[model samples]
Target: MVEEQEKRRSSEDEIDLIELTRSIWAGRLFIAKVTSVFIIIGLIIAFTSPVEYEATCKLLPESQEAQMPSLGGLAGLAGLAGVDLSSMGGSSGVMTPQLYPEIVNSLPFILEVMNDTIYFERQDIHATSFNYFKNIVKPSVMGYILKYTIGLPGLIFSNKPEDIISTKDDLSFYRISKEDWRLIESFKERIILEIDSETGIVEVMVEMPDPYAAAQIAKKIELMVTGAVVEYKTGKSLKNLEFILEAHDESKRKYESVQYQLARSTDRNRNVNSATAQIELKKLEYEFNLAYEVYKGLSSQVEQAKIKLKEETPVFTVLEPVRIPGDKSKPKRAVILIVLMVMGCMIGTIILFCKFILVGKRGRSF
Candidate 1:
């Protein structure tokens, strides 16, 4: 008796699946029409979307300051008090690679990028990144729609553009008004920065409409960050170099003066046969030796300072040089069309399934 009931339920399940499949097959034309409409829409969107070019750069940040002669020194003693010796270019640990993204996105770093002059090959024009964004870069159709429609409230409340006054010598003095500030902040969206912990490599990527500009921006940000790191690491070493240079110069002058005086004294009393002459010669010898030793010590210090500077200035080894991507990084037209088509087909299939079930053809099975 149980075996017979199981067979009946199995037969009902098979019939329900067949009916569903048949219902889907009968409305295949409707499914095709809906899918075609979505595909057309997808094509329109894919073609109209802005083509974005990506530029990528990778670098390894190396700290060689500890290799400088006697890097630990008295900084080791001061470390007991929780004092950071990095301020004096000593034993303190170097900045971690993780904060590189923050540095790259920082206001000063972006400003440095803005000050750079780049040629937009496609547009056949020369302009700073900031100026190009301000005067050029026309809005896309979608951007306009969003601004007036979905983003209408935010756009209405946004600050008005400011008329900045400036001249050739004072271009940097223009007050960055609220609207300009917002525009400048928008640069953060076009850049990406990351660090690979396992490999200890820094990667920076930039996107722009023009390939050349994209590549330039990537390289420019790399240079700015490199310069900043080098400057920070070698700050104390450079100052030490300056002080040693000055001391070396002064000691050299004193040594020369002593030699000159001794020469004059010997020449003036070359034939003297008295104790006074002997005492004068001894005094000049003592002064000359003192100046020579001081000069020699300063010379050695000068050399040491130079070596320290070289060691402290970190070398940013480029693991991957910035390359102009051959294809647009966005829009993925084929994928977009496939997704839209699949969505349309699913909707059409569901509509057919509901219509067939609600007509009472498969009501008994449910």
Candidate 2:
């Protein structure tokens, strides 16, 4: 009797599943209509969206410093064996690759970038990146729709067009024009800077309407960022070199003066006052020796400065150079259609569920 009851329960569950399947099938026409409407919307968006070309470049910055064993570690190990090595290895507080993006995004850097000349082949337009970003490119259909719809309030309350373009007396690099500021913001949005933690590799990406422009900008940024980093790294060394050069020059001049004075004194007392002449010669020789030492010391320091300049220089290895993208990077129509279809299915399911529940409740109440 128990086995028969279990079998009956299984059969009943199967019947319920079949009923559910049939109910879902009944809504097939509704689902198809909703899906078709979404597909049409996707088509409109896909065709109307602006085509953006992306340029990509990869970089490997100096990670060798971390890999090289420090002299400090060797010094510490010596201490463990009863020798003092506390002063062996000392590292400077140089900015790491992680802060590279921050440096690039700084005001001065952006201003420099704005001054760069960009030539667009398709448009035959030659202008500064500032103007290229500001006036040449047209907004996509969706971008336009959002401006009048979602962004309407901001536009309505914003500054006048004339004020944004005004350059009467406000030509300071620090205080950029309103239109230029907006362009900078947009330019920032289109640039991608990604650094991998494990590999210490940097990937830069640039996207623009024109393929040539995208690639050109990407290459330009790569060179600019590397140069900025190298300059930062070697700044102290360069200043030190300059100081050494000036000190050496001054020391040499003093040495020359002492030599001339010593010669004049020796010639004047060549045959008279032997004791006074000896004392005077000794004093002049001491002065000459001191100056000579300073000059020689500075000569060594200058060589050391050159070495420091080389050591502090940052190495940026280009693993993947910038390439012009052949295809559009935005307005993925397949994704749009799929998302809309899923949304429609969910709405349809909810409606059918509520209808069935209400009808069943009415039947039971009756």
Candidate 3:
């Protein structure tokens, strides 16, 4: 009885060890199967993903003082009004030129970008293509659905427009506006504009799927923005100069009339009593001289305004030009293949392990 009991205990120990090993090794087949599924999906994704190309353009912003002379002008004007302009010229306040970059990235600028279909389409195609591969191609179940139903049909029948200009003519105004805004926002996020603190230069960078399009849009936008800046500044300067000219003309007429009167009085007076009259004449002469000086000053100011207006306009020099890229930036195939292969192996192994566990249990029970 003691030997039989010992044998039964040994048998129980063996069973426990086997169960422990099986449980650990169990569903490895499932893991392998899942991994295999992932690998295959990854491979398909890598293969089908579209290629993207990038283009970049660089530029520098204009001089800070030229861009925002209002603060300086107002300071000078305040001094003339007998107010202490220096105190009001707050150094703590934000600089006006710093706000320019924000204006460039503003909604209006973004809207302008949307109005151009070429920019919008390039952004959309790149984004949508990547999303499709990542979400639809990677999941095992989704992979099956895509392969059996969507994949082949999409390759053959997908009618995604090649570029934005081609699609815009077909889209209604509302549709165009909506799609364009979306693309603009996306492009804005991708594009960068920076001002160098030390040199006060502006750097602009735009990244797009089409290298040429990216370069083209960057150049076009820079020119548009520069033209706008020039137009606005020039208009203000011209108006100021017009007023200055009018004031100068009025002062000149006054000065000339006074000088003529003074000249006639000096010629006619020849007696000792002419001394008192001469003093009066000298006083009027002084007034005339003062008016003449003011007119001269204003004329000089008009010339200065013209120069400032010209200099303030932003100018761009292309540092880099976009060229046709030989390679696309998208659809990394090797990564996708490795991921899918691992998934497939995990899935297949899990199935094999489940069968092994169930069969071994049934034989032992029988």
Candidate 4:
């Protein structure tokens, strides 16, 4: 009977669910303290961060226009020869279009941009092209010597005479043998390239301190790319395409004249009933025809070249121009403040909860 009574008393001593809830409510101060801490830290991060403004433009690489005559002539030739030319139609004569975006980012292209004042003069902190420490050789060498005298280990590596020269005149020394390669690396760092995998539309983005400057740089890049494509497409290549056409016309006239004369000779010999003379005339006609064919092929190639050039001039349909940003992209104050306050509150709550659990555990152990 005594053992049964003791067991009943112990069962009744177990924690009650309602009582625990009352205890937790009594610890409202602990929850309030945790929430306060997180809010303060979040605000600090939001205010101090640097603001970055981005300018972006959309572009589609210029696609080549098919020269209908060239394709027709090739198809005709293939048909007459009883060969299939369907596979050739898919080929662009050049490499795949997929590779062009990377090619645009190549060193040569980067170097061209670097030479522009928009990139070189405005982008960097130094307002002028002259960074005196980089330009004047004497100051640079003296600085290096001074560093060496001061026991600076970095100066020991500066052994070459050119290396000792001021880096300002040509920053390419550190960039490697190629100026273009250096520019490419620098440009890549400053510019962001994004391409839509499905649509194949490209977004060229640049972030700068000034919104206007960012917009200008983006605009300049578009113009440069357009001009480059134009030059590449038209084999008239800085030369007038009209000139090549005129020369091609003259060649055609000369070839046709030779062909016409040979034809006349064969007819005359046949009319005279001279088989031997006819055979000789036939030989001349074959040669003239061969020359005429060569001239025709050359004429076709020149026209195709012109057509290809026209296709290379890339035009961008600007989906969105660079807008003057109203808000700075950095230092998201509200988010930072909220996060910091939440974290602080979490830490405080954890500390209070652990203290409560530890106190309860100690009392039970005692």
Candidate 5:
């Protein structure tokens, strides 16, 4: 009796599945209409979307070990002994690759990038990045729609002050307006920087509507970051060089004075055989030699300091150079269409099921 009841329940389940399938087949026309509407919407979105091009460049910071190969073996041994020898040989403090991303994202760095001149191929104009983004780049169709509808309040009641202090007038402080802050946010979105800590490699990516502009901005950012890094790493070394140069100049002057005194004393005492004259001549010669040695030592220190400054300055090797992208990076129309169509089908099925359930309940009530 149990087996017979189980068979009956299984048969009913199959019948229910068949009925649901037939219901869907009968309402195919309704589903098609929903899907068609979605497809049209998708087409509008895909077409109206702004195309963007991305340019990327990879940079590898020259390692401290690579810069000083002679010290590499010693450094390794010292590491085993729990001592760091990487800072030896007049090398300045290390600026790790991990800090590079922070450097690129910094406000000052972004402002520098914004002030750089970029050539827009489409517009056939050269302008500062700030001006191009603010004035030249126009809003998209949806952007305008949203601005008028959702963002209309902000426009009407904008709190932007008219008499804002300019950076040029107040060099010590930076005061930015609301619009400028929005522009800066947009710039942060366009510029992307990534770093690999293990390998100390940095990748900079910039996306812009214009391909040439994207490439140009990417290259400019790369150079700017390199310059910043070099400046940070060599700051101490430069100061050392300057101090050594001053000492070298002072020593040189003293050496010259002593040499002149020694020459005068020797010439005056040439005819005298007196002990006092001989003693005076010896003292002047000794003074001259002492001054000469000090001067020579400072001169060597000056050369060494200059060399150290050069060595401490970082070098960035471009693993992948920036190039104008041939194809757009966004607006995947096919994917968009497929997604919209699937959403439409799901919505149509839900509506049909709800209607069918309501009708069945009303029939049973009757």
Candidate 6:
């Protein structure tokens, strides 16, 4: 009896599926009209959207070994001569690949990048990034609509006179008004940077309304990032170099003065034959020798500090240089059309099913 009941239930299920299919087939014309309307709307959206061009570049950071120079031999020799040379040796700090993203996202670095001048091909003019974003670049049709509609509340709350006046008075480097912050946020969205941890490769992409502008910004950002990295890595070494240079100058002056004194004393005492004069000559000679050795050691340290600074400066090799993209990166019309059409079909099918169910319920009531 159970097997017979199961067979009957399966038959009823198959019948329902057939009825659903027949109902959909009968409503094919309605579905087609809905799809056609969606297609037209999709075409309008695709053509009216703002066009964007993308440019990308890849960089490989040169890895450096942070080994300090071996000063054991020199230290041993200096020790025998009763001079200390241990304070001159130092190791440079290493910057890892992970910090590249942080450096790029830093406020100061971003501000510097925005301050760069770039040429816009569409307008045939040169302008800084801040000016271009603020005054030159116009909003798209959809952007204007949404700004007044969904974003209207934010605009109302953010535009107080006190807020603007306070930000304007602050002349600090990091202080920015709401409008400037909006521009910065927009600019940040256009530029993307990523670093691969294992290979130490960096990829940067920039998107803009003009192809030339996109490529130009990409190249500029690449150079800025490299400069920032070099400056950070060599900061300590540069300071050390400066200090060594100052010490070196002072040591040379002292050594020269002592040598002069020794020379004058020898000339004055050439005719004297007293034990006191001889002892005084020996003391002056010893002072001059000690000054000469200190000067020599400082001179060596100056050279080493310069070499270390050069070594710490990192080199970035461009694997893929930025190029002007020939095609627009957005407004994929074909994809938009297909997705809209599929959505229309689903909506039409649901409507037809609802209608069929309501009619069947009325027939059962009768």
The all-Cα superposition gives candidate 5 an RMSD in Å to the true structure of 5.1
The residue pairs in collision within model 2 are none
Q: Lowest summed lDDT over 10 consecutive residues: which window, candidate 1?
A: 84-93
lDDT tens string, model 3, 1-366?
A: 999999998997798668756764775665665776687667666765545555555555444454456557754654464434333221122234356567678765665654554433434443332233333224345446665685676557545443443324766333233334444565577566676677655566665555655665666666766666656545665576678778878877887887787777767764547667878877877877887787667766655554454444444555655454556655567766776676577556656656666877898799
Total residue pair clashes for candidate 1 = 0
Give the winner by TM-score: 2 or 3: 2
What are the models' TM-scores? 0.76, 0.76, 0.46, 0.51, 0.82, 0.82
Write the residue-wise lDDT of candidate 1 on 208-298 in tens digits: 8899999999988898888877777777778879988998999999999999999998887899978998899889989999999898778
Off by over 4 Å in 1: 1-34, 63-93, 161-178, 273-283, 347-366
The segments of candidate 4 whose C-alpha lies over 4 angstroms from its true place after superposition are 1-37, 60-116, 119-190, 220-297, 309-315
Please give the lDDT score for candidate 3. Answer: 0.59
lDDT of each: 0.80, 0.75, 0.59, 0.57, 0.84, 0.82
Shift of residue 66 alpha carbon in model 5, Å: 2.4
Cα error, residue 305 of model 6, in Å, equals: 2.0
Residue-wise C-alpha lDDT for candidate 2, range 128-220, written one tens digit per residue: 777776677777788899879997887677554444322356564354555467678877888788889899899988988788888988998
Deviating ranges (above 4 Å) for candidate 5: 1-17, 70-92, 163-165, 168-172, 197-199, 273-283, 354-366
Between prediction 1 and prediction 6, the one with superior TM-score is 6
The TM-score measured for candidate 2 stands at 0.76
Q: Which stretches of candidate 2 lie over 4 Å from their true place?
A: 1-20, 64-91, 160-183, 260-283, 342-351, 354-366
Candidate No. with top lDDT = 5
Give the winner by lDDT: 1 or 5.
5
Residue lDDT tens for model 6, 230-299: 8888888899899999999999999999999999999999999999999999999999999999999898
Give the TM-score comparing model 4 with the true structure, all chains together. 0.51
User: Candidate 1, after superposition: displacement of residue 272 in Å?
Assistant: 3.8
